[model samples]
Target chain A: MKKNLKWAAIFGSVLLVCLGVIIFGQFSHGTTSAEIYVDGKLYKVIDDLERQKFQSLRVETEHGYNIICYELGKIWVSESDCANQTCKKYGKASLVGETIICAPHKLVIKIVGTDYDKADVTT
Target chain B: MRNNTTVQKIALIGVLTALSLGIYAVEAQIPVSNIGGIKLGLANVVTLCAMMFAGRLAACCVLGIRIVLAAAFYGTFVSFMFSLVGGVLACAVMCLLIGLFDRKQLWVVSVFGAIAHNTGQLIVAAVISGTGSVLSLAPYLAISAILTGILTGLTAQRLWFSPLKRFRITQTRDGK
Candidate 1:
């Protein structure tokens, strides 16, 4: 019975993860808008109002790098002068539990909900 | 067989704890993939070693001391609780599961450890935040855990079988 329980727990966890991926994928399907900025100046506006509600703002720096930001969340440099492209691969972060960071570029992308004072995992 | 002296036991635990802290600090300095709290978890190597060498109780003691010391050194007591609960639960699960496998199956143990660690942390986060939304990141964390676990486990397997395997004085029958 104990052995069965362990296997059951493992399978149950895996199943829940699959379900979560599907649900999150759907939640990210709504059209959202984003504003791109370079050096603290407005560069472009990705007006994809028909895209996902959690639209990501992608900024290409003058140094041939990209910074991504979620319209409903925080801003982070997705790519920069680093051999390891860990940040760029992180893609877009929109949920309260999501984050994007470029340590070399000191770029941080975070998600801030309507209630900033709420007890968030980010804190 | 000669048992470890009190001084030797304390020293061993202390050294293991220090090594764990060093791994934590070093990993903190590196800017890895930011999936949010996804870490190399190098300190876990030490925890795994402790479980292999000492008994499960000793492993738990070392983990408890390491978490408390790490929290006091770097973050707050609240953060310490998160690490303590997560590390202890993960290590316990990993040790128990690994008992079923031989040395060749160290990778399996590593994978279990990483998954357990993430699960423990997520549970704590859910409780602290009072919301289940943080549970959304479980998939991402699981994927990362598997990847890192394989790497760390391979390394650990090699370390365990190496000629310099002076850590374990009295190996468990299952360890063979």
Candidate 2:
């Protein structure tokens, strides 16, 4: 029993540490960029949408279409043809590691930054 | 062991299934402002309790039926697929770890089950979204799983030895 508790404690601490790193990474500032992917392919990359101030792109895919709205430092799916409006409800995310996914539409909007390697940070 | 008949086992599984479905509905109404696809998974408590008091097969029966009924009541086909994936993966991990862990370490098993559930859901999300970016949320999902798993695990651990023995669905090994 004591050994079980010890194991639980060890696993719990490891999860906590990983969570802390993710949170810290989320808060830290880095070069502002965003990536949009559809059906596992890169659809668009906004290197300086922050400078563009405001823009909207209507993306059409085999699943459906989504109107991706970009602001100073955030991106979102303003409109979607999916049954559930979860993607639209996600609204906007400006953080370095934030994301909005339209599952029904197979659309992904992710906030990327130059400071971190996207593939390395996540499993 | 005399009370652990087939009829009693079926009734117990049915009751637990209903309870889990009810929990799922109530949890859906609770607004949780967190990352996408994260849930408290309160219904899993019933699954865990069923697994401990009854057996893995009984637990699987309850979980499978509960998820199906719950999805039919308030979820779409896509949502149902996600639930099926998460629920099956979680139960599989929990049942597999039962023999691995000695003592009353149900919590550890529960935590691993939660992690498995989240991983399954994450994979679904990644596939649906068509990007590996959804994997970025893994850490947050892991954290949520740990917290919620501890809650459900402790509840099951307590209920395992509670007065609900009268409804004993499985024969006790040590004749409690």
Candidate 3:
């Protein structure tokens, strides 16, 4: 391979990866809402939670149950009956597209704040 | 002198496999934080070096053994799947590029190989999670691959420049 071409291929691949990240970021931007899913289906969508401020919810699936706590614009799994405490131990999630998954329960909590929902000023 | 012979070749492959496994075990012990699938993958140094010292087939053999042994010793089915795919992809990419450039440019080959490895892992991650959102990590993993690849490639380069050359069989001048 030509030396110049080799260099181009290396830089080109990096550029493509960066572009992909940018596009994904733009599409998933904002964190005004949180979408909860169970077994690949939409479970619930918590929107404009700032009005209520501190909010908590319980999500129970056939596999088990989870207590999700939302406070100060952050979400976390405070309790789960699943054998693996990975979700409970995940701590806090505030970023857009961030997720807390309880695999055993097949439950997923994903941040999906759209631009119109407004960013949480308190955070 | 240990000239090119079937027994010598097989012995070299065995030694390389052992070295790769040793490095892999050590790497597995290091603590990782907020893992987005980033890894040092230092064991790849032996895989790349095997290409330079033995051949493409020998490198594949080394990587295959290392992956199987590692999975049997320290991996779950899920972890084994991830490593098997990543290791196979990385070894294949490196072997493909091994003959394209001289040993001085092994990092180029390694960079592509590492990227391929990460891509493989990312795919497995997405499939296991049953979501494409996990792909958001692609860019981050790619960047990390470049850095780690350079590190492992330079290590292999140094070994090639050292007395390790004496261990190289009298087969291909470029050693494939």
Candidate 4:
């Protein structure tokens, strides 16, 4: 029984450390761009090049459609045709490496880290 | 175990399966704030309890039936696939842990089981969506697993002393 407690404590500490890393990583990864993928392929990149304060795109295909909206540094699915609406429920994602995935539609919208946040805008 | 007649074994398995399915149904309705796909995994209590009291095969039977029936009743084909992979992985990990650790350490088994289940689901999600970004969500899922696993494991431990414990099928043949 004592040995079990010791193991539990060790596992608990490891999990706590992992949680700390994930939470810290989520908040700190400076995101300057968002990437959208459909059916495992890259579809679009949203950055300063778009020049819109707020923009919405209707991603459509034979499977379905999702209306993705983005502003400044954050992105989210404003509308979708999927039954569960998980994408919409995921709300806004702004942190670097954060993602909103719609499994039914095979769509993934992710906020990606970028070192060239400005040079990309110029080119 | 050989102590339990085939008829008794069948009856116990049926009851546990039904209970697990019912718990799963109830669990689905309770939403986790912010996280869409995350669940408390309360139904794991039944699986853990079965593994401890009944035999491994009986626990596997209960887990299998619960996954298949739940998916058939309330899930899509894709969801069923996720459940099958996750449930099988979780059960396998739990079974292995149960053998390695003392019976009093069931919570450890439950914790690892939950982590295995989440990993399986995350892999399936990544494959289906074709995004490695899904892997980023692992830490959150792991946190949930630790809490939920402890809860379900303690619940099972509490249940081990209930009148229902009589259904335990002890190994008599080879003491395996």
Candidate 5:
């Protein structure tokens, strides 16, 4: 019985450590630009967000809509027409991999740029 | 050992569904975590126990009814989609693991099932949101799956030895 538990504990611990490393790596990689993807396709990129004082980008899709608000260092869903409001509840995030998702509309706001360019700088 | 008469199978599935739905109602009232998809998932105890006592088919019947009924009662279409994916994947994982684990290692099956459930939900969230970055939530979800899985697994294990014996619905080791 003790041996059985030992196996489960070992497997569980290994999984936990692997996941932890991924999360830590994401937070440590900083980016000021945020990209909005509508249904997995890139819609827009807000580059060098620090230069912008405040902005609200409205993304209206066939499924629903979400208003993504961005400022100096962070991005968030300020308002949404989705069912659960999960994106709004997610509040705000500024890290490189951070994302605000409105599932009902399939909208995603992800932090994905660097200090090199205006986060909105998309060619 | 349980009889496999038509009426008996129907009654077994019905009973399992009722018990799980009741458990679901109570669990719904309690919010264990602030995160949207994170919860103790106590109702899953009944589903797991059904798999052990009844059979995989019966357990699936119970789970399917519970998901549909719960959604009809209060859940939105989006929540319904999430539950369907999570519940089905979780059940499938348990069905596969049940054959491999020692009878006493039922907790292992439960833990794996819980993680599969969380993974299923995470995948749907990522797809619906349109980015893989939502995977940033993976580590947190995995950690929760382990803790809650252990608790629910241990609980199911205790019942397997205790009350489930009296309510046993099938003699067949259906998965094996």
Candidate 6:
């Protein structure tokens, strides 16, 4: 049973990857509103027009980290002071599938759309 | 050599707890790569080392203490639970695998631990979000886990072999 579970996990993992790729490929483009949050608080809301300009917006939070959003066409963390910077270099968030995260402050900026809203975000 | 006394054990656990907290704080302060929740997971090195040098029970104690203290320091109990569950499960599985193998495959165990850690966290995230779709991130998390695991495991291996080599040799010799 343990052996079976391991194999199942491997196969399930592969299947999930294929599914994610398919879903990502399918919804890769569209004009959508972008939302940003800092420390679980709503910080910025960018519409399709603002998203196109792809300019930089700096969000100063109560926490020590300063979130710099660059490239309006897609939302990406251009700069951040957090230790990992994993969220800062994510480049830009395009499509409904992308997200930028700063784990220390428990902050997450994701592209939420109707499909994602129905599928995941909403409990 | 004699076994560590209670005070020594407590002091060691305290030191590891502090180390893990320091790593966690430092990780939060610097921005390295922005891949959505990807972290260096430096604390795992200490946890893995504790397992090898001290014992599985000792490692568990250190890991548990570290998670609890770190969570309290951060003031996020919910997320702490996620970390604790994920981290403990991963460490236990890795230790078990390593014990079973009886080989110098620290990197393999590290990778397994990391993947397991991510899997545990993903499970919590999915449950919290009330959607199975969050499972979509599993592959990405797995890839990151494998990379970080190797890095952390290598560090642990060096730390274990360098200063503590004599102690390890003695322990194995005495056992036989």
What is every candidate's C-alpha DockQ against the true complex, given to 2 decimals?
0.12, 0.42, 0.21, 0.48, 0.34, 0.16
Report the lDDT tens digits of candidate 5 across residue range B43-92: 88888888887778888889999999998986788889889999999999
The reply for model 2, stretches above 4 Å from the true place, is: A27-29, A48-58, A67-79, A88-92, A116-123, B1-4, B172-176
Q: Runs in model 5 with CA error above 4 Å?
A: A31-34, A44-58, A68-78, A89-98, A111-123, B1-9, B25-36, B172-176
- Summarize candidate 3's per-residue lDDT along B68-105 as a digit string, tens digits: 99888876566677888988888888878888888778
Q: How far is A47's C-alpha from truth in model 2 (Å)?
A: 3.5
lDDT, candidate 1, A72-115, per-residue tens: 33344444654434456665554443534333332333342333
Q: How good is model 4 by TM-score? A: 0.85
Instruction: Let me know the TM-score candidate 2 reaches against the reference structure.
Output: 0.83
Score each candidate by Cα lDDT.
0.61, 0.79, 0.75, 0.80, 0.78, 0.66
User: Using DockQ as the measure, what is the rank order of every candidate, best first?
Assistant: 4, 2, 5, 3, 6, 1
Against the native chain B, each candidate's TM-score is 0.87, 0.91, 0.93, 0.91, 0.90, 0.86
lDDT of 2 by residue, B138-165 (tens): 7767788888888888787777767974
- Per-residue error for A70 in candidate 6, Å, reads 9.1
For residues A1-123, what per-residue lDDT tens digits would candidate 5 score against the true structure? Answer: 896869677767867795677566555543567888888889998877656688898889888778888888878888888876667776677756556667788887777646334323543
Top lDDT model: 4
* Positional deviation of residue A55's Cα in model 4 after best superposition, in angstroms: 5.3
Clashing pairs in 2: none
**Which residue pairs clash within candidate 4?**
none
Model 1 C-alpha lDDT per residue in residues B71-173, reported as the tens digit of each score: 7777555456568777977888886987896676776687788888888877765564444545656666777777777778777777888874675645442
**Residues A1-123, candidate 4, lDDT per residue (tens digit)?**
788779788878978897787667655533467788898889988864224488889999557999999877767888998866668877777765567888889998876665554555667
Candidate 1 total steric clashes: 7
Q: Please rank every candidate by lDDT, starting with the best.
A: 4, 2, 5, 3, 6, 1
Name the lDDT value of residue B118 in candidate 1.
Answer: 80
TM-score head-to-head 2 vs 4, winner: 4
Residue A50 in candidate 1 has what lDDT? 33
* Candidate no. 5 TM-score: 0.77
Candidate 2 positional error at A85, Å: 3.8
- Which 10 consecutive positions of candidate 1 chain B have the poorest summed lDDT? B1-10
lDDT of 6 by residue, B14-96 (tens): 67667877887787666554444677799898888777766677778888877877777764655675797798779778878
